[model samples]
Target: MLFLFFCPGSFGADTDEVFVMEGDSVSLTCLKKNQQDRIKWYYNDIRIAQMNGDPSKTCTDVQCNEGTERFRDRLKLDHLTGSLTITNIRDTDAGEYKLLITRGNSDSEKIFSVSVHDKVFVMEGDSVSLTGLKKNQQDRIKWYYNDIRIAQMNGDPSKTCTDVQCNEGTERFRDRLKLDHLTGSLTITNIRDTDAGEYKLLITRGNSDSEKIFSVSVTGVPAAEQDEVKRKTVKEGESVTLDLDVKRNPNDVMTWHFNDILIAEITEDQSQICTDFQCENGEERFRDRLELDHQTGSLTIMNTRNTDSGEYKLKINSISRRRRRSVSSEKRFDVTVTASGLSSGAVAGIVVVLLVSALTAVGVGVIYHRHRSPRKAVEEKQRASVESPNKEKEIFLQTQIEIT
Candidate 1:
């Protein structure tokens, strides 16, 4: 799994981005004020380690039982201070690293970013070294071929492996690959043409992942030999002719298959037995629609249907005049039958309906505007007429006060 780092800053800080060359070690600190609570470590949202709640029973580094396989032995958990130290990082290990600690009823979290650089080269039948960037710690390297796990080197939590216990790879890589247990570098010997593809190294430590991708290409692949597949598209209910162009012979044998099911066969004596069309053993699906041209061994369907769209295979056996055995050859044809689109009459009907609907909408809008304009004018005139009486009453009151 690859992760996108979301936190900011680089190195040392609580939410920092740590950049390291492909095979270096980095330490991520998780400080907690509460010493009695358990400390949990997560990488890209996956919980990788959790210490016992009691700090007295906690050790310096304890491997977790349940988590991602990439983090198996690379984590050095500090039970005393809740810090993590990762060794021998690979490029894949770059991502978000998080630490969770709870004290009393309050919880705290710390997130960091780690990036590892990866470099690779392609070669045929040559050994390649993927440096783990850390030395003497032999437990955190895993190699994968095309995303399938091929090998891994790991050791016990109490001590690093001086004599590495690396597991054998899958069947395709058996006895061909080797890993340096001390530094986490992978070397494959006796590389073959089939081994040309993607290889990845996943180094996980401090609850984070570093990855390296290697692409390999090999020369010398035999050229493929096969007849070109002929393609044809025909409208449904139309006539279609499939040409075989084989000359009839006394010892010649011919067979026809539709989608790999034998539909017709011709014996060496020029006798035909068929479940397809125009033969003695006729099938119901193709009964009256099929016709066979005996001289050229061609098949013609008068009314092609959508169900007839499929691959058609023709096999011919040419019998040598001197030898008793026959040499077989085959040709393939792909036929597609499609429905002819809507007719002109149907299109005309649809256009007529659309035009009528548009005109009706326009007429309705015009009628609404014409009726609403007069009503609006009448309401405004009535409002002006009502305000004139109030204005006259106010003037009369002022005149009476002046006279008094």
Candidate 2:
């Protein structure tokens, strides 16, 4: 969490790469993003090519009858010049492609380029694969969870999606979790394991946040842990499963550190998982150690405590390329606690079942005056005031094991 690692040195630059085209072999590899023994290339401004050229020949060209006339078969350089390999592409050979550099030896132009993608398509099977990115129709499309932004239109009616999931503890299936209309989608009827997750579909046009990363692989069937605060054992009582696999995003702001100092800060813009055990912190001992299995974000720790060890984080937010905006994926869980715990024989068996039900209610009131049968002594005093042998031996077993 050193703020996404001392800031991720700018976010976009590979000679600014973005030359989507088609028609045949086109290799415009003139990369000098920041530095490289000099660079050069210009077409309409005439100059030909030269990016450390003449090492063994690597900038070739030949267009005889495709885009009108040309300078005839030319392939300059001997080593590795500015890069060029246009073989039979047309569309009048497009336009604008420059990169002239030189400041150490004085000759400059720095860098200035552009590319308008003309092809980008994909289609693949049974789950989902709808693609399209041109941007117009009012230019503003938002859909995320993988990069934070779950459907926003700017044409706000108070901006809704329940304002992006407002604290949903449980309802068994109240209206079954919605958001399928704006077409950003977040549906659920039955998809189990509490619906394994990692969904995305963010498409924004104005403020630019696009480079395609639309993923979706949910598989639900889990609930019970939004109210959290019920998975015991503190410093000595071992035993723990109380699942918890949680994730969150909004440019990332999640902090669930239990010992390194901090215990829960999932602003809930969206990112969930908690196969339930119990956890909370607006109060209480605040414990829900995280198990989020919406397809493995893995935070399972059942029986360990020096107060349950330390170091934990989830911090979010990211956008670099000099565009600046840090904090992205801050993970560092190192919890490890053990003193070989002990629960004092389960607290002396709950204090000998409350001192033998107070000596069996004073020997059933002196044997109910020696003759008994007062409705069998009031049904054994209401089963010893309701279950006490450690809550009647906790017998709840159901086995159907066939899991393949």
Candidate 3:
């Protein structure tokens, strides 16, 4: 977060430009000094703060304007110097501010123009547009990559040009650039590794010009080299290793970046090795879970989580002793981490099989009992007929009694 201050002589209506990030503080100073001078600040033509010669009549922030809460309590005014400080600024704060100084019967105004910059991240083959313009704007817009003009649009007739069209015979971004004629926004399609760099958008409207910068980072390798990237799939809580598969040199410096963020690094001769926060703060996602092979520079991730699924890129820079140049190479790995349990479909299939097996067993037992009962009753009748006359008579009487 950088704060830029440009103070012009406070007599005429000169404009000063300031650039800052969101959530940053900016001070718009009124350089004119007079004991009896009164100062008032206006944002987009709305009064936001004021300082009077009478100490009891001074007001700042919400006290200045009760009808609007845009500034809230984030505004501060210096009673002595008449400088206005805005704390915790937001995107809406990027606009024009006016400071009026009154001395006796004369009044002078100073203008402050503020702009906020942003960062953008994308994967290879994706499209992203840099935006900072209003609809139907008539300003002349120019887009530059690393300070080289890449695209532009003119207000008159809404003419637009890109890449080789913008600069003669330059085909670096021939078919990948798109410029919006309406809003003057620049879009890059089928983005590549060579397209990852700082982009500046300069808007020229009349005599006042405002610039916005965007830091673009592409995650994966180029489309032509996409087949070379290694892909791995692992279950949760499992460990996966991404092997460099190349012999390590004593003068080689290896670095590993996850989603374009540095997470592990090893210096020449393996003298210094760091992982996660040891390499960069606020990178605790892989804390205590990353390991690097000292000999081959391979990376091993332990206890992997679903959040760890992304692109991991390795860059190796080898310093040549005889040759005064360094050789560099990069390798990418796409990892997919899945949950460590059976899928719902698989579990349902197993349950259905168990239920079918139980039903089949019950049907077989019932059929077997029905077939054996008739044969057993016939065998009992034959034994009774073969008995003696007296025993037969007794059996006949017992059967008659059971019948009755």
Best by TM-score: 3
Root-mean-square deviation of every model: 35.6, 22.5, 18.8
Badly placed stretches (over 4 Å) of model 2 are 1-81, 84-139, 142-152, 156-236, 239-253, 256-281, 287-404
C-alpha lDDT of candidate 3 relative to the true structure: 0.76
Off by over 4 Å in 3: 1-10, 121-127, 133-142, 152-161, 174-185, 189-230, 234-404
lDDT of candidate 2? 0.40
Give one digit per residue, the lDDT tens place, for model 3 in 106-141: 988889888754546666765666666553466888
User: Backbone clash tally for model 3?
Assistant: 0
TM-scores for every candidate against the unseen true structure = 0.28, 0.28, 0.47
Candidate 1 positional error at 10, Å:
92
lDDT-better candidate, 1 vs 2? 1
**Candidate 1: residue 340 lDDT (0-100):** 72
Shift of residue 81 alpha carbon in model 2, Å: 6.5
**Candidate models: Cα lDDT each:** 0.62, 0.40, 0.76
Q: Which ten residues in a row have the lowest lDDT in candidate 3?
A: 320-329
